[model samples]
Target: MHNNEQLPNQPTGCGQFDPRFLAQIRRNLFSEIGANNAQGLSKNLRQQLEGLPRNVRKEVVEEIGDQCAALFYACESGNVETVDYLVKVCGASIEQRGISMCSMVHEEDWYFCTPLGGACAAERLPVVKYLLELGAAVNGSSECGSTPLHIACGVSRIDIVEYLVEHGANVRQRNHSGETCLMFAVLSESLCGYLISQGVDVKARDLYGRTALHYAIEGGNSQTVQLLLEHGADPFAETRYGNDPLQTACLTGALSIAHYFIIRYNYTAERLADTLELLGTTMIDTSNTQAVMYWRLANQLRWAVPRYIQKRPEILPRSAFENRVEFSTGADLDAIAVDEDAIRYQGLIILERILGIGHEHTIQVMTDVGYQYEHSVQRDSRKCMDMWLLALQMRVQKHSILHYKTCTTARSIVRLMENVLHRNVTQNDPNTLRFEDVFAMFQLLVSNILETRHLLSVQPISRVQQDNHDNTVRCLTHLIYLLLSTAGNQTERRLVESSVRDLLRHDIRCVRTNESLLHLSVSRLKMLESEYVVDKSGTVGIFPNVNVTNLLLECGADVDAFDRTKSTPLHTACLPLNHDREVVRALVEHGAHLDRPNLYGDSPASLLAGNLANDVVLGKHISLKCICANTVVGSGIPYQGIVHRMLEGFIRAHEPV
Candidate 1:
């Protein structure tokens, strides 16, 4: 046992004061506080010699800081009355954090200060509500970027989630990992649905580039995948490493999900090849004693073989190598035969390749084998199994192994990429090929993308090389342009919208990169729209494709960006007869400056505030767009339902009804 003096940052050498005596004093103080013995505590505090030494008393007072120790205990115990008295009578600050003298990391959010956060951690929702009403920051984030709402949602405290949301906790707020409350809610489909309905980006990627769909797929929750898809989650959304939902579903053996994508989309063969490539090898090791132990289990036994062979060196003698030898029924020889029977198995290669299970899972199988061998090796009762060594008397056939030709399919995909992606795609009219078909071709090409990208480092881009780059970019840019143009055609729009986003995924998901295609698309859009500055494309064109706009914001776009005319995207959306609620909501959710003035000293908010139709058109029972547009964050008035009612009245008076 060590003294408190040995502990890092623990104080020591207080005259004759002992550590054991100090521990007893701490225990007594907490016990009294826990029992709410205020009179006993006051008496103990007055009796300095009996309670604590004069020097220790100064140390205790200095360590905890001015008399707010009671507040931490009260908050931990959910003692609201004591908290009220401490804050009001003693002038204790609710925001006051107890600074630790120790060198360890502090619980910046969960404790120290923040009575509201403390009460929430204890599931004291009523106390949480009370503290919030008394002016606790609803959006106060903890050390790990977890807000009260983040904690509540994580613990499935829906009541707390509701309260925080209603009090204006930002639902779009990300944690330290760039995960949203909605990402946490994926484990609960109902919560996920509600968050999606609130306009949280279904397209949002976490730090790992996994969308909500990726999480749902990885979790094997098919129903949750359906829910995210319904909310416009892109099926082809890729991680930074390029594993999309299909690759993830196949890897996890989510057959229902893999089948769902296969039925809807094409190129299942190419996708499987990519999965096999990711696994590093196409075949598992096969041996004769397969029924007893698989390749994975046998691989672990290989290490023990040398030790076992050393014990029975006669099995590897030079005399046996020189002359034809016959083994006698010796105990060592029998033990070797038994050991061999216990661990030798063949590969189940082709099926494993198609199923997508690999070394990662077999590593766990090793643990399972060890546990079973330890617990059941001594069992006398025989199992329904045949040992190849014992049953056949060592006469089992030693067959040659074969492997699946995954690379054959991979080569075919490469040829297909060279065929499709080598030509100028935009040279032909976008209407010549359906955007959906073009995007499917793009998915296949990129899915089977050759290591030829590595060649760029080896040599300069030639005319042929530049053609390859131009063709892919042309395919992507044209797909985006066509998708934008075909917004009036409902079925085509639905079919190609996701593909357009898929093409833009690289630009959208990256925080910093060359958006050559995206920048070109935006410039082309402005060039295409010479007469009209705004279109009523709610989720798409009003302010650039909503997907492109969102990707820009995620990649750090300036919200108050002005064109040569000093008009922001907000100004474009608010132009007469061109207003879109979804576009405005999207902009505001990403922290777009509401009051950033363009040229001529006019803010976008002022433009909307002047327009009665903007409010009326955005009119609904607590319309989010109205809240988003009107909720000037620093104005002190967050979104309120009453604000909607007031606007609805203004709309009714202006309308014929």
Candidate 2:
């Protein structure tokens, strides 16, 4: 026999309902029953099924109408009469499956549930009993391997759970994630106790090796946690990620659970101190006032009064807090409790000590701690720069210079420099920012850009690489503006000039847009809308930056070079949002044509004429040589063969719009 062929006694007509009857079932039977008008729903359903042929009527009982079978809907709605009518009178299959909309499993993915599973999830005890009496599989599972018992326990239907166990529900069965019903029942103390008494494993481990005690602690129910502990659940059971119950409790802010474990469990002193430090750092990040309590607890465990120092790990990094806390006494903890900066720095110190300097999360916390200092009421720029600089150095060592983590850390440092420079210039606070430090950071930023340009030269770039490329260009422009602002001496000015020349010598352009440095500096589109472009100190960069433009021009950047839009840098300066005539005069001085056109036939002169309509002196800015070239171009005579190639190209650029 063929594999596709059905046996003679096998039910073949199931799910073969007539189209009209299926529509009627959806239109009347399901809606009315859902609206709680089940008194006549059975009669309405039977009448609708009677119009179809016998085979169709028998199959219509199991036909899936609206993402589920009619019997499944009847079970979920608690309409036992309709459910019985479909099973008995219409010969419906007791184990019919359909899409479950209210599955206890993952709601984001699709899961198929049996009618018995649906009834149990809805807490329809009567329908559940009837379906079980009709011999529906008590252990029938959904697509996610969740049985009726799993559903009952998840919804805390204790009565149904007891009834199912009295019959034949398996208490030890695990779902797809290897989670038993007891794992989901840990939220309810009574349900957990009942499941334990009925042979559910108190020490059951999920796919991740998490025990019921982990779930109990995560639920924040001290009573449930105590019950699980009394029933022999391991308090120190670690998951695949090495998270014990106490670690989970700390991460979840379950103070009572942490306290219970601390007093009741026999953890070693060093392990307890580490976990307490983790808890303290976590609480500090959330602004919880209780952080000092945990820190003091850890401190007491590590150091006792009168002269007792804990054994220290050899070769600790400079990022560790060993230097700051070497001589701290009880009075130091009290000081940290009142000082916000002390609390924040203490958190960073503890995080780095526990997670190590090479960990990514440690580097991220360093950056965040730096931000807290930079933006806090104290405005400690020196400390902020120190932390950010450390983070940037570590990120560069761990990942490539073009990596997103490295790029983000570098961007933060650049933003800080800009803010400090703006403050120094506008508020006359020169001591707030240092020119040497900003110059050093600028050198690193330029090296990263050059390396990225080299990578794009020999290889195809992904979308992320393209974004990093654009970000580097934007950061470089912001730094250029800052360096110009802080150039107080000839030495500083010479350094800035040399760096600009080095970049232009590389022939670098934005890989994504193919825009030259001059184009990005002139337009300032990307920098204006960047996510890191915060102007909290009102330090917005100047638009159409004439100094950066002139600097690029002096560094051998093509003043009339065309971008991807086929428009020169001069076209960008003439834009409505960036219509700065000083930049226009600078570009014209650098030999930019007055009548150069782009792909859209919009020349600088044409655009400027529309923008500066009242400024009749605009013509004075256009030299006589440009006017003659514009005239020759408008005459449409063949100048390509009659003139020098350079002059022919100039005439072509001056074509009238």
Candidate 3:
């Protein structure tokens, strides 16, 4: 091990500290504090440590700072009594710092801090004063460089903020992110006013180059924005992303703040129109149906503005959708307000145009819009598929073929295709799911699988990479099932066959289950069953599709390959839940040996016999080669020495259960 490399399970230079004991102490502290028995708590804790050797006890006491310390817990719980006991008797350092383990309102909300910072975070002003009196550093920072004043202001603890500042906490201190107390205090109007009065810079930019006004706008607090602006916060101050207060308000869907900016800041009529359009588009990305509200507001504001300032263009630029909708001046903006479909697509188009087609945000909004279309009252599969196709094209270009985003989008499309095909078949509609789209999606999946295998050949793969490869494989299988379901014409059938052949030519196996595509198609694995039931489309038990089974075999899939359970495709097909006779017949026709046993010593023929209660005979006319192999195995011959090296394993596979 290199000197610089640390074991993940062990902290630096503290091998003697046992994390289990620390966890036990946490549990005991909570229970004991709840019982209000501070004396018993201290006594029991000391006894737990007394069992260890003196050196280990000292190490545990000192190393508590490296973990969640008792002092921080006491501070957070406002248990001043425990704070004194731990520091005075238990040898805990007064300045001990660690992750605060109290007041866990959220799982990920805990933070690393000293005792004073912990108290301030929990808003326990009494505990803050007690820690300060105990000589806790008033200006002590947490692991993130956040001082007590920073925490106090962030959570709007104005009283605590005043006390900390009076106790000599630096009001101008910047954290590791270059954020001052003023930046964190922007959410509180009184706190912001006080911090400004104390000489904190109101216009100070953080490491992200965002001013206090920008933070206030993003926080969606008008009063805080008002206070910061009155204190000289620049409304035109831009962040590193070039987003000012108005743009921040638009992005965050803060319509009231945007309105307030126009009322107080006197934004131009053109600027208000642009902001309203941006706001409407943002709402479309988030709220599918409520996006028209902003369009109506924009029209109302347009009419409210003075007639002289209404020098708008005859027609705004068309949105980037296929429909290319354009809004004319004045009353024409109301058209989009009434058309929900236009509102949905126009929002997606505006986002893609602003964020770039290949940006992750664009991809996400596109996928979200597609989901809304799919689940709408009419189940608009056409619009849904269109959005997903656009998203898939961008994802394939922007991300790796096996990236989770690309794989996820492709899987969603395949599942949608399944639902569409089932609906079409039930409704007797021949033109519901287009054959060209299925073929195109199938070709994309095959290309991704082949590319993933190529990458695997050139580089060692990680677990994440292997899982992604398996996911892509599953996507390909579901897609092929769709193709097989709708192979109505000779051209479509040929496309499906060619794609399956291209996919099966690679030596791909599901990395998690170690099952080949043939095994997966035949067995209907447990994970795949629940995954197939995406919605209440009522297309259950569609897997083990006989056409998909035969297609894989026709594409030259290995029929006798062993999965992780040492079961061949035949053994899997013979399982009770997956006893599809057609699948079994297909496998047998593909030269799957019926008498081959799995690792559990159960042959396909025997398992099938057990399942059928001798109702039908299978593999009755055994070949002479199989008879010889069975005779050697049944007679307990040492075939490993007598038979050819390749034939030895094959002969052993036929041994009796």
Candidate 4:
């Protein structure tokens, strides 16, 4: 290294200390301190401090003043004679506050001033002894409420910690967060050993109700955790979240610490079994089946299947049964190949096994492929009825399929639907008449079949009596709506009208009641109108039969049902955005809440805002009721009157906006 004397000076133009001069002082200071001078010569050399700027000089003086004030710091740090000179000649004083140098001394300074914290950190003995003998405060706290003992314990400085404890440093001094020295020790192995030697309280808890053992387990320091347990840290201590250390360790995948707790705390096999069972149950209850599988896999890999069997033999049998199927070596067909009705059932079984095997990417590919196939089938005139039936069957089967419980499975199914819908809308063809018929059929299936099934399944059976006759009537009503919506030939129209009249006279009294199902029905009805409602006047009747809307309302459907935009049925119908106005009028008559805003902040009135003629025609008799009364109105006013004009002028003048 170059000597400080050879270094270049700071430019005069800088108007700061010569960088070279400062560098030389720094070099000499470090060298002098490292030399641990034993004579008065070092003190006489202090005159060199005058060469620095006044501000720099003050800083150096304050720094040296601390050194001079804590003479024992020098002595404890093995600078005996230099400390003597500083104390005797420099007027260094020893105050009752221990080193008493300055409040500026940091936590790291405690380690440097004396060997107590350092020796504890490094497991040194003689250095610690000299410091203790020279009146070093073994229990002195730094800015963070950390004592030398805390430092020693935190870093596993067993020997220094023991030395400090023996010299009367309080073993129980808590830090800013009420974590005691023993708790700090549990953060590291060496400190744990030192605290154990000193008989420190190991069972102490922090402000968060976390005991030393909890920290050890949470920190995944297995050796420290074992030491804590050996010293009687409570294994059963629970955090504010009601989770014991073991559960926390398990959740965080700290297997070593978890095992230590289990072994040392005498955690029973039955208790472990119960924990696993509860974990699985909670996963299902919280819709976290993915986590359930992860935990199960962890238990298998870490402890081995034998241990799992010993805990819960039932899982082993289930696992064995599920994995019994043999997959083909190199199957390379697209996912849609499995969409055939005969193959779908087998494919579902195979897919469930694939999921169990954890081939997640493969499952995703299969779901995507299956969705594409379903879309193609819907768009093929010859395959429309088959596709609809297959979709209905697949949806029903999903409810019974255990595989669908996982979030991944649910997400895959949703992606499948989205892909199918996109493909169907893009592939419209005049030759595909049956394909055109599929949209109306889908509406019937979703509204009449799916909704009724879900209602019966979810409703409180004990609270209501079932009527088989009413079910038929409802089914017939759905068939009539489908027929009218798909009215192509006069024959089909007459058949549908006759069916509607017959269902209207039926004594059965069941009506559609589920919102999602109702939305599905309306969406399907709208799709039908889009495909087949062109009229002689060059106008499109993209409206569902008015009777269908009336029937839905009678069955307790909200006439003003909103889309994700909070756009009511009337809003959807009235918007010139390619929808049916007649449908909008029908919904308005049936008591649809017109004021509900969509996600876009547009209400029925706002949706018609751009169409002055339509707005004038509809706005006169419309209600201004809001879904959420406290809702703020948008910027546009209903009307601009004289009062509004005066307010606008006053506001503009005051705020200049």
Candidate 5:
């Protein structure tokens, strides 16, 4: 009773068994018997006969060998010879597992509890081949409906894949996970290359709709990318996440992959143009100083690239218009068929170039367009003009205002004033002057006119009756005095003096009552006398008739009035070391306070004594202390507070000590 021996009463001929098949089955059964009992089968003849058919049953009964069962056991034990013998000699069903109880089990279902499944899990090529020889269906399902090929692929067994696929394994078959063998190959680069060479579908996608190409891009594998692309994988194919391969490459900073997609792949012309434009604009937006540099480089490459400029000849070549220029000269001008739309588009491109360079070229081009086709360029021409004007205005105003506020020293102011005067002279023509220069000049001219008018209206006895008349008078007088002292030429001086004298005799009594008029009158009279020593009686006598010094005395003009520098009238009048003496005498007799001490501790008497004779009695009754108190109080709170505190401290210190 060998384990592999056939049973005599086994139902073999019951289901269409041919003699050749039965003989082969019997031979396999005998082979299994020999291997199961290595010592040899039992010698008793009745042992083999007990299960044999009876004389009547012998005609119908055919014995089936135990080869399949023996081979299953051999595979479980990893016995190579026994499994091979059973497969070749027995003619046992290759798809059958070992005999189970009373029936033969299908090899496909045997994976439920068999060591054969374990062999497949270990990725043993021998075990896979042995099972296939014993009629193991290559595409047969396991317990969970996964074929052996599926299990092999999941384990990334390249050998198993080769063996199974060679032996008619279904490559497209999926497991319960809905993943094919190709997906498994994609998980391993070696496996992927092997499968691709073996004709595995590289374009196959998984349950997530991601193809092998998608995975390669996501992983940023340059080798895999090149392989897939070489095999006709679409570079422009978007993933399930809606990102194209190029975008993925850029985002991952995969330079190699990006270069392949951009340079090797035949991307659409429009898409290439748009992508480059976006890159350029984004780089510019992110930087400040080097924005133009980046933009120009980007655009240069974009234009030079044949894909972007093949059809746009207007933008591509400078000689395109030269041809048209010659053609237009002929009598029959070929219908003058200019592509205005194309020209406009080219204009936009030129504009972008101009903005990037930020040079005079852009302005020149725009100006040329305006001049060449002024009537036809109504809308664009106006826009160009506005842009030029705005740019110029910004440049000039920024320089002028910044200099005036930050650098107000005498030397700097003088230089700035000289520059302004020079520009005014040089750029007198409105056509030649930039908008910024014109704007600055307009402000200056308006300011001068308003000041001149105000001075004429606020002069004493002038007819200027209006609601803000006092403020008007004060502002006008101050402006006139500044102009008189700082006027750049004789024209400015004459204009200031004329306006001052007109206001001095203005019919309006309120204007006549303004205290600033008397000060302006004396200043103007002195300027007239200095400018014209012999003919000074004309304008200078106007002040003498009004008697500014007397008028100021009546109007409570502090003779020792000092500005922030604390210079008294006498100290200021005696500046340059040689002013007219009659003007000084008039100021003195009209109650000019002579004993007033300025911030520098110099009295009007001391100021005059330095240069003028100290014994010159200009006034009879001069309250020196009153004059000093008036000037001190009018000098603002800091100076006034200092004087009061000093007096208080003196009285307290003397009383205590």
Candidate 6:
């Protein structure tokens, strides 16, 4: 009667072979290895095998060897008694390993080694203790060097981690990724204290020269980073790419860690030399050091500013850039000048980073921020490339085109456009994109064929970025929708739409409805295709797209939220003109309501019937979906709208009673 109780011939979750013969009939198994029955039932198979004639029994036993029948299922389910019975009574090898079919397909060997690894990963304390007592190799690694210790730390199994280390497991051994048990321990703050006490190397760097401190910083685990540092970790250790802990912290957006590092590394004269030393030059020259610091400040700010603009701009304190500089505030900054200082110190670069992320009040904010006088048009003309380009492109006035003549060359334009379109723009994705990204988005969406051809004339983006063009498409569509849906000035919309046909570029004369207001990027679903995560309970779920979806949602895109015509993004994704199914799957996976009706009172499933209008049987197949809106409104109300009546009835006949 239990939910996971196996039917007679089914293989349990822990990896048992269903006889190829029996696989044809009722072959479904438990979705995951369930709790093992403590009452030994290893002999249950004996009765089934004994019922066969002598020759048939011999053949079945030969086909499925005694070793194979030892089914690691008991260990996976943590059934100590069942494992004991299989080992003692059925002659199963105590150390017999099980090859995980899931691991094989995904190329991730979580349960790759002996059953003990699976037991440890499952945090089955009793099963693990039993296996270790039975002489299972404590240091055995799977193909990926994933050991019991690594698994324990990953799952935050502190008790099991302490037990394994106490029982001869090597605490300092690195995995195939060159990460140590301590590196994995970042996942468990509790594991860090124990591993360090057991004498694991607190300062061990990975192949990338990233110490546990770097991992901790990247993980936003300030507590763990502090723990590692207190245990003698080199907080000043730099990666091979020259990223010190603070710089790495900045890149990873761990502002708290960066702040902590700053307070510790700076805020005094004692570590000023040390801070400069970490920047990687043995220099006594104060001027050179200040310049380098300026550049480093710019480098860090360039990344930090854009990110802050997009998601956490409000968090950017007035003194955020103050800690990086040594001079008193408002002192002699003008003397240095834009071109005179590091590229990071350029007025245009600072302005673009702060206000260029498509905000309507960007220009006014510049004026209010009191930096406009500092960055006058004359200065921008001389130093800032982005401003120069914007001037050339947006200035429809008589002399705006003169920027190209006065400041830039023809070859420079092509080179700059190519670099902007291809590299910087792509790197700045919709998730974290600002001015450059918006520019590229507009270019791709609004530009005509000749313009697109011209942009790609240098080098085409061959399968750029994170695999497919889904993210780009999603970002552009979202941008277009945001612009069109907002009650902006008609002149602005007309100008923008006219400039880029992709915005609201459809023919008004056409009869068909265009779901421009809603966001349904078919490419969005393709994002979820390969993303996955292994939970604490050892269950794998396809939820890696959580970040992408979360970022969009946080940025104010709605799921059940509809466009002007009442179509939600989900309804838009399922349009017959755009039935990627993946888009629908992605939205549903991200918690979109499946049965929600659109403005026209039609569910997403009902919209799929549009493509099948000519096919009688398929139309009927989606019938129940067709009447969903009417059903919700009440049968007594009757279907009043004539527009949806034909499509609804054509499909409604197939609805289940």
Write down the lDDT of every candidate, Cα atoms only. Answer: 0.46, 0.73, 0.71, 0.46, 0.44, 0.48
Q: TM-score for all predictions?
A: 0.35, 0.57, 0.61, 0.34, 0.25, 0.39
Best by lDDT: 2
Output the number of the TM-score-best candidate. 3
- Ordered list by lDDT, greatest first: 2, 3, 6, 1, 4, 5
Candidate 1: tens digits of C-alpha lDDT, residues 1-657: 111122123344546656555554444444544665433243443343244455555344223423335455555566566556445444445554432111111122232335555565666686677677768788776545656666665555667777888899888998766767776666667777777766788888888787878877876778888888877899998787456888778556565787687677776333433343222221221222332222223223333344421111232222201222222223323333334322211111222233322233332232223223223555211110111011111111110000111222122222222222333345353213234433444454343223233443444333334334334443344444444443446776655555544444443211122234433333323322111112222113322455655554554555545454455566565555555555566666655545545556565566677776654322332345435443444354444454578754433222111
> Candidate 5 at residue 471, lDDT?
36
Better structure of 2 and 5 per lDDT: 2
What would the per-residue lDDT of candidate 3 be over residues 1-657, giving only the tens digit for each residue? Answer: 111212124244534655765555545554554454535355556566565566555455555534666566667777778776667666667677777533321112345778788888889898888878888899888766778888888888899999998889999998776888887776678888888889989889888788878777877889988888887889888777567888778777888998788777777776776677678887775674456666666657766756533423332342225556444354555566567777766676555544456756567777887887788787777677877877888888776666767767876787777778777544345328877788888777666677656665444455556767787777677777777777788887887888788767776788777788888776555333223126745246666778878988898889888887778988888888888878887888778887877778888888887786333357563567887898887887787877688898779778744
- Model 4 clash pairs are 120-157, 156-191, 565-598, 565-599, 566-598
Residue 445, candidate 2: Cα error in Å is: 1.5
- Could you tell me which 10 consecutive residues in candidate 3 have the lowest summed lDDT? 1-10
Worst 10 residues of 1 by lDDT: 395-404
Q: What is the alpha-carbon lDDT for the whole of candidate 2?
A: 0.73
Rate residue 255 of model 4 by lDDT: 56
User: Where is model 5 more than 4 Å wrong at Cα?
Assistant: 1-120, 142-146, 154-156, 176-178, 187-194, 197-199, 218-221, 246-259, 266-657
TM-score of 5: 0.25
What TM-score quantifies how close candidate 4 is to the native fold? 0.34
- lDDT by residue (tens digit), candidate 4, 557-635: 5555534445556655556653445555556677665555556656666666676446335554454433212122243
lDDT of 2 by residue, 127-192 (tens): 999998999999998877888888888777899999999989999999887889987777788988
The list of candidate 6 runs beyond 4 A from truth reads 1-35, 40-46, 49-70, 89-111, 187-190, 267-657
C-alpha RMSD in Å of predicted model 5 compared with the true structure: 40.7
lDDT of 6: 0.48
Candidate 5: clashing residue pairs, number: 17
Model 6, span 1-657: residue lDDT tens: 223324345455543446653332111211222334455443434454444445544433223222332346567678787666545544455555654322111123344456777777667899999988878889888656778888788777899998998899999898776778888778557788988988889888877688888888877888998888899999779776556787666545565787688887654332332232223211112244444454354334434433421221222222212212222122333333232332232332333333342222222222222222223443221122333333333321221211222112211222222222333323334322234333443453333222222222244332222122223233344444333433246675564454434333321110123322235333233122111111121111211233333334444445655455656666666666555544555566555554556656776666665655322232333336444654644554445465387755533432332
In model 2, what is the error at residue 142, expressed in angstroms? 26
